[model samples]
Target: MLKIQDIRELIKAIDQSSIEEFKYEQDGTKITMRKERKMIEQVQQVVQQAPISIPQQVVTTVQPQVENIVEKEVKQETPAVKPTNLHKITSPMVGTFYSSPSPDSAPYIKVGDQVKSDSVVCIVEAMKLMNEIEAEIKGEIVEILVENGQLVEYGQELFLVKPE
Candidate 1:
């Protein structure tokens, strides 16, 4: 018989494991657990950052799983768009978006401002580090998609630019 504690322990084990899903059945009782895709991705990212050595066979097996996760994430993040001349400046990493270098300072760029390819447009703070985001394309700022100090995700659109 599976008690609530037993099920909870099983879930904890699964969360800590590399396996994506688990199932068990006996005496007409069945239990199954599956980790969310995002959780799996976060685990994979942490594992990649560590210098732990993995067996060749394990590496080969994990490659396909990682590719699948990346594909799913890309599909979810990308939206269909009608053909437009506007170029979008996107967030390079997940963080808190800031328009100005400091609270009292003017914003880096505002609507109708012309920017060069290397122009600093905004900052994104992650893990106490302030990352200056840039306009990778030469253009005029048409729209600002994020408000100052808003949380943003990787690849989220920050500004729309009409190419020069």
Candidate 2:
């Protein structure tokens, strides 16, 4: 059983030593020190001028709060509707979007290129493997949504397909 007087004595010793931090533990008591630069400088000036010791102890305990949410009862804000003119070709997996399968080869397709269903539109590089993404609809490519060598997230739109 450690008494409060022991804590006072340890603080006094720390003040006399001119140290920044001090820690001591005896049985059930654990005392930790955090020294402020301004307080230390003031104490040093006072000690040099008159040599008086003051000990102040502070203990802080914080309990983490848990967030409670009832989904059925919670009022959620719905996003405003967005209008899309062209049919979008979205990535099925996370990968680097590639216009061509090989570096020296011409791009599989470009904007204004007409494509049939099952035609290879682009290749996506995922985990060192090249995946050929096919055009699901026979259409003219209206726009390219992403650039070659660009990092594409899962379900990210890659191209805009307009049916011929």
Candidate 3:
């Protein structure tokens, strides 16, 4: 049996890492995951019983923050100006990231999908409650920062958009 605080801590730690997906299994218990990328998106965390102990393997895959590092190295070549063209849609809560309403449903938006404000872009389920996330700024979804079913943090970036 796992304590509530233990699971909460694990969730927090996962949110801070570059790894976008993670799962934990022990004997008859299992936990599935999903995370948001640029902004706030909801999450659906499902815990259930398993017939066998699902092997515990932590695989990390993150879109590198390479630009940040490269910027430091090329201090002289930089124009010393900031980019002002990108707009971000953020999650209002900490949860999972989903491109569709359900597993069998088609995603609302894809990488190149053009969208308007108030468009439902994804769903995040937390504490067994599903929440719909909307795009408040019209734009093209440039990058999906999260993988399906990964856990996320409060105020996390869910999407990167190029505003129209």
Cα lDDT for residue 121, model 1?
Answer: 98
For residues 12-50, what per-residue lDDT tens digits would candidate 1 score against the true structure?
577688888888999998766565455655766675577
Superposition TM-score, candidate 1 onto the true structure: 0.50
Report clash pairs, candidate 2. Answer: none
Per-model TM values vs. the true structure? 0.50, 0.49, 0.55
Model 2 per-residue lDDT tens digits across residues 63-110:
121112223212232333433666788998766789997899999998
For all candidates in order, the CA lDDT equals 0.82, 0.72, 0.72
Model 1: how far residue 142 lies from native, Å: 0.3
Candidate with best lDDT:
1
Of 1 and 2, which scores higher on lDDT?
A: 1
Q: How many clashes in each candidate?
A: 0, 0, 21
CA error at residue 42 for candidate 2, angstroms? 50
Better of 1 and 3 by TM-score: 3
> Which candidate should be chosen as best, given TM-score against the real structure?
3
Candidate 1: residue pairs that collide: none
